[model samples]
Target: MARDPNEPMPDGSGCALQEPFALQVLGADMEPEFPDKCVVIIEPTEFCRSGMYVFAEVEGVRWFRQYLRDEQGRERLVALNDIFPAIELNGLDWKVLGVIIQRNIRRKIKTYEYADGPSNQPHGSINAVDITAS
Candidate 1:
C-alpha cells in the first residue's frame, strides 16, 4: 500500500484502521455517472480490473478516475466527462488505493409512471417522479 505523502506519522490513534471508505465526488470530470456530491464506496482490498473506477496516486497527488488501458497497452486514467483530458501513466509514482464498488446518489433520480390506471390503457401519459431517498 502506498502511504500518503502528507499524512502525519502514525501516533497509534488507530485512524488508519477501518473498513471500506466513502468519498464524495467533487467535480464535473466524472459527471453523468458519478455526479458531484455523490458518495462512492471504495474497497481497498478488491482486485482492480481494466475499466474499473479507482482512486490512484499520480506524482504524489491523489486522483479519482477510471482505470483503463490505451491502444498501445499503456495504463491511463480517464475522466468520464470528455471535457477533462486523460492522464497518461508514465514516470509518475502511482498506486491504486481502491476500486469503487458502489455509488450513493445524493441527487434525485427521475422516474416516469403511468398517471392513469393501467387496464390495457393506450397512450397514457406518464407522471414524472423523483426518487430522492438514499
Candidate 2:
C-alpha cells in the first residue's frame, strides 16, 4: 500500500527509507490489546523492548502478540486473550514484523476487544499493549 507523501507518522517516523507493511486485521484475537478497527503501525526499526506489543508473522500468519521472554532466557510470544496462545522459540521461527507503536481507536467510553480493553467491559485496555523495551 502507498502512504500519502504528506502523511506523517507519529514521532516523525518517515516512510522514505522504510518499507511500510500493510496487513488486514482478522478479528478479536488480539483485542483489549489493540483496538478492533484501529490501524496498527508496525515500526520494524524501533527497538522492541521486552513486554512491548509486537506485530509478528508466524507459520505464514500475521498477528499481534505480546513479545514475552520467560526467566529461562527464552523468547516467547503470547496472546493477551485468556486463551493465552503461546509460541515457543523451540520450533517456530517467529518473525518480528515490527513493533506496535501507535493505534487509532474510536469509542465514546473506550471499549477494547482484547483482554485489556476495559474492566467493566475487564477483557483490559485497548491502549494497554505494553511497549517498554527490555
Candidate 3:
C-alpha cells in the first residue's frame, strides 16, 4: 500500500520538517515522565498554554521543556527533573515550536492529551495514558 505524502514517518523520512516530528529524548532532564531514549511526537502549534510539555527555541537555542505560567502570568521553561535550573522567559526571546503529544517507550505508546474544561489540574495540563495495540 502507498503511504500518504503528508503523514509524518517514524524515521522522519520524506516528511516536511515543519510538520509534526519525532525526537528522541537524549538526557535525564525530563526523566521519570519522559525517560531518556524515549521518542516523543511534537505537534507544531503557536497556542501553547501553561503546564504543557513543549519544544521551544530560546535565544537561538532549542530546548524541550515544560511550559509554565505563574499566577502573575510570568512564563518559564522548566525541566521535570529538579536538578536542571528553570529558564525564565520574563525578558528572553523565546518561541514555542510545538507541544509533545505522544511518547514511545520501548514498544509502548503513551499519549498526552490536553484537558478540555476547567479542572483541578493546571491550565492546559495533559492527561497521559498508555495506549495498547490490539
* Per-residue alpha-carbon lDDT of candidate 2 for residues 1-134, written as tens digits (9 for 90 to 100): 98777966666355653665534445676766454565665566533545666787778886687766555778777776656567775578567767665554442222222332213422123344434333
Looking at model 1, the pairs that clash are none
Q: What alpha-carbon RMSD in Å does predicted model 2 have with respect to the real structure?
A: 10.1
RMSD of each: 12.2, 10.1, 6.5
Give the Cα lDDT of each candidate. Answer: 0.69, 0.57, 0.87
The CA lDDT at 93 in model 1 is 73
TM-score: model 2 vs. ground truth: 0.57
60-118 in candidate 1: lDDT tens per residue?
89888877754477888889898999898866678888866666774445433333333
Among all candidates shown, the one with the greatest TM-score: 3
For all predicted structures, in order, the TM-scores are 0.65, 0.57, 0.81
Please give, for residues 1-134, the per-residue lDDT of candidate 3 as tens digits: 99887976775344475588899999999988899999999998777878889999999999999988877989999998999999999999889889999999998999998765445674345799899685
Better of 1 and 3 by lDDT: 3
Question: Which regions of candidate 2 are displaced past 4 Å?
Answer: 1-24, 107-134
